[model samples]
Every structure is written in C-alpha cells, then in structure tokens.
Target: MKKIFVLDTNVLLHDPQAIFAFDDNEVIIPAVVLEEIDSKKRLADELGRNARSVSRLLDKMRGEGQLHEGIPLPKGGVLKVELNHKSFIRLQEMFGDVTNDNRILAVALNYRLEQEDLAASGTVTAAREVILVSKDVLVRIKADVLGVQAQDYLSDRIIMSSDIYSGYVTLFVHPAVIDEFYTYRYLAVEALQLPVQLNPNEFVILRDEMGSSKSALLRVSMDGGKLEPLYLSNDAVWGITARNAQQRMALELLLNDDIPLVTLNGKAGTGKTLLALAAGLMKVEDEHKYKKLLIARPVVPMGKDIGYLPGEKDEKLRPWMQPIYDNLEFLFDTKKSGDIDKILMGLGSIQVEALTYIRGRSIPGQFIIIDEAQNLTKHEVKTIVSRVGEGSKIVLMGDPEQIDHPYLDSISNGLTHIVERFKGESISGHMTLEKGERSKLAQLAADLL
Candidate 1:
C-alpha cells in the first residue's frame, strides 16, 4: 500500500535529499517545516547550508506543478506541500500552544483523519498509512502520544554498532600455517583457506589450532593477495609506543604511506588523538613525506562559530583545539609555558584549523587529522574528505560512543559512516582501539562512569 509520509523540519535539515527517499509513497511537507527551513536559510553553518539546499530543491520542483496540490517526484513518489491542515483543533486541548511541533503534529493528525474518512466513505479502498518522519527523539515520542506512527529518517544511517568492522580478526589455523607464517615472514592469502573474505589492509592474528601458543601477527596486502608482516619498527613515535595490539594496528595503518586515509574508533582515553598526532608528526616533520601537519575538529552542534571568540583566528581556535595542543606539547616534551606555540611558530610546518574553514579548500601534501570527528554529519565529513588533494593523508579519529551532535548517533555520524564506507577500499584502512593507555584512573573512569 502507498503510505503518506509527513516530514518534520529536522528531517530536511539532516538531509536535504530526504524528500526522494520514500519510494513511490506520498511525501507531504508541512507548511510549518518550510517556515522553519526558511528561518535557518540565512545562517552560515551546515544547518544553514542544508536549509538553502532544501529551498532550492523545493523551488525547482515548484516549476513542475503547484506544491500545494501535489507533484510527481523523479524517484517514484508524489510530493506535496500541505497547507490546509494548519488547524490546531485536534491538538488544542492536548498541546495548548500553537508551536511549530504542534502545528506539524496537527497536519499529520489531520491527514490521518482525512484518509480514514475517505476510506470509510468508500471513496478509496482503504486508508493510506500516515507516518511522521523526524530526527528528533522527543518529537517521535510526542507523535506517538498523539497516535501518529513515527520513524526516524534513516537513509544515511550505516549498520548497527555491534556489527561494525573492527579492522582485525583472529583466525584459528593449523600449527603448520603458523610455523610457515613465521619461517617465510609472509603467507599467501589462499593458504588461509578462509570462509569469509578479508578487506584490504585488514590485520590478522594467526593462532595455532592445535592448542599451542604459537601465533603470528600479520596484515593483508592492499591487493588482498598476500598476508605480509607488519613493517613497523620497534622505535617509538614521538616518544609514544603502542601498548596494546589494537594500538599497534592503528600505528601500522597510520604510518603506512600507501594508505592515504585512516580511521580510528575508540572510547575516551584510548590514545586515539595521541597516536594520530605521533604518526602525523613523524610523517610531516621527520620523514618529510608531507609539506605540513594540519589538524582540525568541529566546533560542534553547528553555528558555534569560532568567530564569536576574541583575538586572531589562532587565538579563537585555541579553546576548541586545546586537546590537539596538549598532544603536541607532550610530543615536543615542552616543560615551559607557551613553549609549544613557539615550537610551532619556529617549525612553520604545522597548522591548526577549524572545521568551519576546512570546507571549500583544497588541502594537498599535508598530514591531516580530524579530531572529534564523530560530532560531524555525513555530508560535512564528505566535504572535508573530498577536499584532500594529491600526496595527502587524512586521519579521522574519535569516540563514536560519545557523540554530541543532535542529529547524529554512533552509526549515523560522519566518522563511523566513513569508516564503514571506506573499509573495503585499498586507499583506506581502519582500527578500533579497545584498550585505554592514558592512565589507570582515566581507564577506570571511562569504564565506571
């Protein structure tokens, strides 16, 4: 049956192309949603950009037919800008104020009654299902209270968090396979006789199936043809060494020049930012592989502009970029105040940037790190990653479980989305660090609190 979907303002803000997502279904945009989108179209953030995009899309569709009556969507759905259902009589007693959310609810509730009335009168065969689509949890709950079927706009959401790829897997093999891996220092992928296919640059732990302790740690070749030994040296990066197996895997991906894109997922205190910075510094300063080290993070929840802060651009970015400064100071072993800043000024090879300015710029031959990446949306991440030019490496690291974006969750955030989407590509690699090496107290707090 063809269902009628009433879209909330947030759904359009979260994704401008959400109108075409419901296949062959009648999608109704509440007039209040348009008002909200119009209100946001003047800002200079991701929300404002999305609001403008939605306005353009709606205007283009208006040329085909009057939006109030209805129009055929290119992707097999009918879209209509609902204007007659603004009456708040159905919700006046339950929700006194004629707020925007209440007005949206009234539109959906009126649609439901109209559908039922037509069905009861035999004007139509049966009532079409009316579903309210929104990204807000409280809005969905309130929709349920008003007896409207509601669901999240999930077109951009990736898989569940539990099934997300962890970059490494353990394979139980015969004792001979482990011995061969050790003797040759590399093994053919066919020798494993695996049941499932491994992704490019995926780490593997070969354990003896004969109940022996013999094992070998290796990684799949970028072409997935061979299991090669890790090329990592015993030397520490920026005075930091991997304390756990997953951290070691993260370094392997981080240090490899062939893999231009790396993603790290971990809980707080798992050393995600530290490892990324160490590898970036080693590549930019020591190896001279990249021209500079550029770091960025979202001044999150959109519209929290660094422009509102005092001083120059660098001074404005200091607060949001303090975590990066701490990591850099530790790497440089700075004991005096303002020493790291002087070192950065003297080095002239490192740049700390805001995520706001990263858009619409081509970044090439730089070791780029995006901290707190989980706070970004998929579109924002796409814009950032697509800006990478020739001879550059971009590392996106963050704690997916600790996202603060109002419209994004663990699976839907830009960090996790890119991790899953790029896991199969040869140019990209991912690692999920499980152990926290910051300190005993910090680890305990992360687990307990």
Candidate 2:
C-alpha cells in the first residue's frame, strides 16, 4: 500500500535527500517545517548549508507545479506542502499548545482524518498510512500519545556498534603456514584458500591450527594477494610505543604512506588520539613526508555550552583543542608551561583548525586528523574528506558510542558511516582498540561507569 510520510524539519536538516528516500510513497512537508528551516538558513554552519540546499531544491521543484496542490517527485510519488491542515482542535484538548511541533502534529493528524473520512465515505478504497518521520525522541513519544505512527529516518544509518568492523580477525592455519610466514616474511593469500575474502590492508593473526603457541601478526597486502609483515611492527613513534596488538595495528596503518585514509575507534583511555598524534608528528617532523600536520575537530560541546567565549580564534578553540594539546605535550615531553607553544612555533608546520572554517578550503600535501568525528553527520564528513587534495592523508578518529550530537547516534554518525564505507577500499584501513592504557582507574571507570 502507498503510504504518506510527514517530514519534520530535523529530518530534512539531517539529510536533505530524504524526500527521495521514501520510494514512491507520498511525502508531505508541513508549512511549519518550512518556517523552522527558514529560521536556520542564515547561520554559517552545516545546518545553514543544509537549510539552503533544501530551500533551493524546493524552489527548483516549484517550477513543475504548485506545491500545495501537489507536485510530482522525480520518484513515482507525489510531493505536497501541507498548508490547509492547521487545525489544532483535536490537539488542544489532549495537549494545549500551538508550538511548531504541535502544529506539525496537527498537520499529520488532519491528513490521517482526511484519509479515514475518504475511505469511510467510499471515496477511496482504503486509508493510506500516515507516518510522522522525525529525528527527535520527545516528538516521537508525543506523536505516539496522539495515536500517530512515528518513525526515525534510517536511510543513512549503517550498522549497530556491536556489528561494526573491528579491522582485525584471527585465522587458524596449519603450523607450516605460520612457519613459512615467519621464514619468508610473506605468505600468499591463495595458500589459505579460505571461505571469505579479506579486505585490503586488513590485519590478521595467523595462529597454528595444531594448538601450538606459534602465531604471526601480519597485514594483508593492499592488493589482497598476500599477507605481509607490519613495517613498523616494533618501532616507537614520538616516544610512544604500542602497548597492545590493536595499537600496533593502528600504528602500522598510521605510519604507512601508501594508505591515505585511516579510522580509529575505541573507548576512552584506549590511546587512539595519542597514537594518531604520534604518527602524525613522525610523518610531518621526522620523515618530512607531508608539508604540515593539520588537526581539526567538530566543536560539539559535551554539555551546555559556555556560550560566546572571549578572545581570538585560537583562544576560543583552546577549550575544545585542549585534549589535542595534552597529547602533543606528552609526545614532546614539555615540562614548562610555555614549552608546547615554543615547540610548535619552532616546528612552523603544525596547525590547529576548527571544523567550521574547513569548508571551501582545499588542503594538499598535509596530514589531516579529524578528532571527535562521531559528532559529525554524513554530509559533513563527505564535505571534509572531499576537501583533501592530492598527496594528503586524512585520519578520522572517534568513539562511535560517545557521540554528542543531538541528532546522531552510534549507527548514523559520520565516524561509523565512513568506517563501514571505507573498510573495503585499498587506500583506507581501520582498527578498534580494545584495551585502555591511560591508567588503571580510568580503564575501570570506562568499563564500569
């Protein structure tokens, strides 16, 4: 049966292409949603960009026909603006308010009643299902209380956290295979002839199938034709050594110039940021592989924002970039208070940027790191990654389960989306650090609290 989907303002803001996602089902936009989108079109952020994109799309579609009467979507469904359904009599009795959310609910409620009336009077064979689509939890609950079917938009969600790719797998092989890998330093993938294909640059632990203690830690070749040894398997970068097998794998990918994109995800105290910073410094200062080290992160606050911070751009970003500075300080071993600033000034190649100013700029011949990427949306991530010019490597690291964005969750955030999307590509590699090396107390808190 053909369904009718009423869109909330947040659904469009989260993903502007949501109109075409319903597959031939009628899509309705409440007039109140337009008001809300218009109010956000002037801000200089991702939300403003999305609001403008949606407005332009709707304006372009207006050439086809009147929106209120209904217009034909490129898909085989009708798109309409709900202008005449402002009645709130049914809602005033249950919840007396005329807020934008209530107004949107009124539009959906009116549509459901109209469909039912038509079906009962024999004007239609049956009533089409009316579903209110939103990204807000409270709105969905209120909709349920009003007897309206509410659903979350799931077009961009990739997978649950438990099902995410860990980037490393244990493979049981014959004792001789492990011995050959150890002796020759490489083993052909054809020798395994396994059931499933391995992704390029995937880490593998080949254990002896005979239950012997012999094991070899190797990484798959970019071409997936052979298993090769980790180049920096035992090397320390910027005075930081890998404390675990997963951390070693992370460093292997991070220090490799062949791979252009790397993603790392783990709980707090897992050394994700620390390892990334170490490798970045090594690439920029030691190897001179890249011209500079550029680090940027989404500015989503953990709790209520302090609001309108004083000082220049760098000072304003100090609070958010403190974690980055802490890692850099540890790597440089700065004891004095002003030592980090002097070291950064002497290097002349390290730059810290807010993600807000990253758009419309092409970054080339640099090592870019985006931390706390879980707060970003799919569109925002694409925008940032697309700005990577030639000879540049980008690393995105964040714990998917620790997202701070109001509209994004573990499955729908940009970090997890990119991890799943890029896992199969030869130019990209990922690792999920399991153990926490920050401190015993910190690890315990992460696991328990």
Candidate No. with top lDDT: 1
| CA RMSD of all predictions | 1.7, 2.4
Which ranges of candidate 1 are over 4 A from the true structure?
A: 302-304
lDDT for 276 (candidate 2): 92
How close to the true structure is residue 329 of candidate 1, measured as C-alpha lDDT? 91
Candidate 2: which stretches are off by over 4 Å?
Answer: 160-162, 301-307
- Candidate 2 achieves a global lDDT of 0.90
Model 1: per-residue lDDT, tens digit, 270-336?
Answer: 9999999999999988899999999999887644666777899888879888999998999999999
**lDDT (Cα, tens digit) per residue for candidate 2, span 40-151:** 8987677888899999999999999999998887779999998865458878888887689988988888888889999999999999999999999988998998888999
Q: TM-score of predicted model 1?
A: 0.95
Report how far off residue 409 is in candidate 2 (Å): 1.6
Clashing pairs in 2: none
